[model samples]
Structure formats: structure tokens, C-alpha cells
Target: MNDSHSAELLRYAAFTADPAGGNPAGVVLDATGLDAADQLAVAADLGYSETAFLTPAAAGGRAFAVRYFSPRAEVPFCGHATVAAAVALAERIGAGELLFETKAGPVPVLVEAGPDGVLAATLTSVEPHVEPVAAADLTEALAALGWSDGELDPAFPPRVAYAGARHLVLAAATRARLAELSYDFERLAALMTRLDLTTLQLVYRESEHVFHVRDPFPVGGVVEDPATGAAAAALGAYLREVHGVQEAELTLHQGEDLGRPGVLRVELRAGDPRIRVSGTAVPIGPRRG
Candidate 1:
């Protein structure tokens, strides 16, 4: 297919209303002809952490089949990409409910226009689960991150959490511990490759409902992610499972150290296992020729 008929590419910064903040993502409104290699090439050219490709499914249904690609490879699911796609669609087709058939599962997204006419998107993930981290793995990860066992928070132990993709959740004892993020990238990338991890979800709980987080995304060919929606969902699930947090709402502050501050909102229901991640997105600008 020719480029003209394939799809319209839109760029947006997700998880933050400001274009200067949050993670940027490329959204293909109708990727009916692009193959996997083409998608990868597009993602590589865009140079975003990840990009979303959307195609209409069989029948006249509104639900779409979505695929996510990083510069290096395809991921099972991507939260920021989903948010970007939702907002892009809303801008063109009007705000409403949308469904995405992803490699992990069906993700439901809600889109609306804010008071200032900015688009906001929210996605409810598939059932989330948490698993205990092996001691040896934790030790190796800590070593790679230059973090000692004593620096970890006793209340929040390390664990592997999954909303769509697996992430290692490590809580810091202090915010300073979270900010000092120099690490051996190659070593952490190798370890993440061995364990099939996407990113390391490092967090510091500021209060019962507020937290600060950073994501080391070595596996995605990026040193760090300014805003990570998938990891935020996984963290919400982990908190609910380990701490029995019955609260329905939580907030995450991220990307401050990177100078790109983004906020992610996580919602948990008492009976539902799915976690909801919400944020606003704004256009980055026109696509490159």
C-alpha cells in the first residue's frame, strides 16, 4: 500500500497534559497495510519509546486490533501508546468508548474532551497479577542498579508485577534513593532480557494515595521511560495484592528527574481485578515528511 492510503500518523505526549512533559508516542489511525517489519521501521524512525498501529477488525465493529512496537521489537502491550492512540482517535472521531484487541487481552479505553478542549484518555487493563521475586534475581538487579539491600523499603518488598507486560517493582526507602538513578545499562539490559522484563518500576510512596516513580526501560532499547502506564498499572495491582489497599484511587508522579514531569492516575475496584490508568494527552506537532 502507498503511504497516502495506509494511515495518518499522529504524535502525542501521554500521561501529561503539557507537551513538554510525559512520554511521546506515534499513533497510526488506520494501519491496514503495514506489516510487522514496516511497523518496526516506523517506530525506529519515530524514535519514541513505543508506537501504536491500529486496524479495523472484521465486520463493522468499532473495536480495533492494535499492535505496539518499540524501536527494537514489538511489546505485548504498551500503556502510553494506548493512551496516545485513544486521544488521537477521539480528536478525529469524537470522544467515546473504544476497545483494543491487544496481544495480552482486550483493553477498554474511554476518551473525553476536557474543559479546555484537551483530550483525556483512560484505559482499563486486563486482570493484573503479582509474583514474588527470587532472591538471587533481586540481588543481581540491586547490584546492577547500584542499590544495596538496606536502601530498599521494608514495607514494600520487591516483586514481579504484570498488568500486560512484566515489570520488576522495587520500592525505595527515600525519594533521594529514587532520584539517584545512575546504573549499568548493559548489565541491566542483559538481566532484563534473561527474565523477559520490560522495565524496572522503581517507586517511592509519598503518602497513602500519592507516589513517585521512575522506570528503567533497558529492554526497550531506551535507558529510561519518562512516563510508563503499564508499570503504573502493575504497581497498583501489586499494592492492592500485598497491602490490601481497598482505596479506589491513587496517583503517581513520574519523570521529574528527567525534567519531564507526568502524572498517572490508577483506579482499583474492590471486586474487579482490572486496574484503570488515566491521563491527558496533547499533540506534539505535525508529522515529519
Candidate 2:
């Protein structure tokens, strides 16, 4: 590892209390001199879905402004990265409110130490909206995913859901169907590129308030995300809009197949269109360099 690689990288697993669970995120506490290319290189080297870069802010509110980068490219916003960044900041400054200016928009995150002294972080995304997926586009996506229309759940129709980033929401009729995730990566990546999609959110509803999800993030150069907070927020919005759930709190379980179990809490209020995702994060370890 070179000197640049030695630049402090904090690892955290977002959306889970255990380090072995949740989505792993690489966080650089001080990204003052790093350029876009350097950031991308670092993320690629880390081999995580996304890495967050923080630079000191001018207003002196939160210590730094944050940026997220996937292995292949820079995303507008990443919820897991946000959670990881917030938790990393909380470790140094104590838990409190953090305001982040992302490519998509401003995101507000609240961090606090739980009763058990574990750091918990909740991020409020930008206002979300649901749109109908074009029939032709759906056909292409289904073809790429090797899923037939019959396997889809009738209750949760296919739609493009956006909460900071766009994701196509698809519900499986059975949990077994959701577990088997074999898809054409190149084909799906091409389709997502054309559709401007971030990930394909595949879900199975266990109950009215409980769901299991898997996210195919081909665009981010990952076959499947172990845990995806952005897609979880989008899924919550889709459920609220289509199912008309009165209560705003919902639970999501993900990454079971990948063996990295994670839990995400989705909160939606009556008047608030923005979705809130809450989770606990634990540091993975010190940076390699």
C-alpha cells in the first residue's frame, strides 16, 4: 500500500450491529486533496459496493461534506454509505445530526448511541415518488432477469421507484423464487444503463409490515448488493403508494443468501413523503494501508 492508500479509511458495516453482517462501506475521514479519479481508485481497491469521501465543510456544522463512489462509478446518493459515514462521524464527535450535500440533493442523518452503546444511524432521504414502468422496458428487464411474468406478485405491481436514486421494484410470489438469483449481468447492466436505473429491487412480503429484499446492482459493478439501504427506502415508498399502509414503520431483512444478515427499519410519516431508513453500524477494522 502506498502513502495515498494509507490515508485513513474507516470500514463499517451498515444496517447491522455485527461486523460480519450488513453492507460494508469504506469511509475516508479526510478527502481534502483526493480528486475524483483518486476516489474511484480507492473505492475499486476497497472492493465494496460504495465508499464515502468526506471533506471539511465551510459552515462548521457537521465536520465534513460527503461523496459516494461505487466500484465502477460515482452514484448520486448511497444510503448505506450515508449510514456508514454518519456512524463514523459519531464515533469521533459523538452522535448527533449530520447534514450531507450529495449529488442527488441534501440528505439529513441522525446518529445516536443506543442504550447498549452501539451507534445507530438514521438517514432521511429526499422526497420520493413512484412512476409506472413502461411495458416494453419491463419486458426487457424481465428477460434479462430470467423471470417470467407468472412469478411476479399481482399485489405489488412493477414500478420505477425513486428515493434519491431510481430503482425498478419487482415483487416475487414466493420466497424460494427470491432466493434463487441468477441473472445475465451484462444484459441487465445494459438494460439498467438504458433505463437509468441504480438497482433492481426484488422483494418478497412475509407480512403486512415485514419484507425480504435483494438488490441487483449491475450498474455499480456488483452482481448483488448484500444489503441495500437505498433500495429499501425506495421499496418503502412503493409499498406506501401502492398498498396504502397507514403506519409508516416497516422492517426489512436482507443479505441472508449472501450470509451477511442485515436489518433495516423504514419509517414513513403521514405528511412526510421522504422515507427514513435506520440501522446500526459497527466498524470493520482499520484501513489496510
Which residue pairs clash within candidate 1?
none
The RMSD (Cα, Å) of candidate 1 is 1.7
Model 1 lDDT vs. the true structure? 0.91
Each candidate's clash count? 0, 0
The residue-by-residue lDDT of candidate 1 on 1-289, one tens digit each, is 3353255678899998898999999899788888888888888888889999999866346688999998888999999999999998888788999999999999999998889888888999989999998999999999999999999999999999999999999999999999999999999999999998999999999998999999998877888999999999999899998999866799999999999999999999888889999999989977643
Model 2 bad stretches (over 4 Å): 1-6
Backbone collision tally, model 2:
0
lDDT tens readout by residue for model 2, 1-289: 2345757888999999999999999999888788888889999989899999988777676846778898998988898988999998989888899888887788889998889999999999898889999999999999999999999999999999999899999999999999999999999999999988999999999998899999999898999998888898898889889888645789999999899999999998887888999999999966554
TM-score of candidate 2 relative to the true fold: 0.96
Clashes of 1: 0
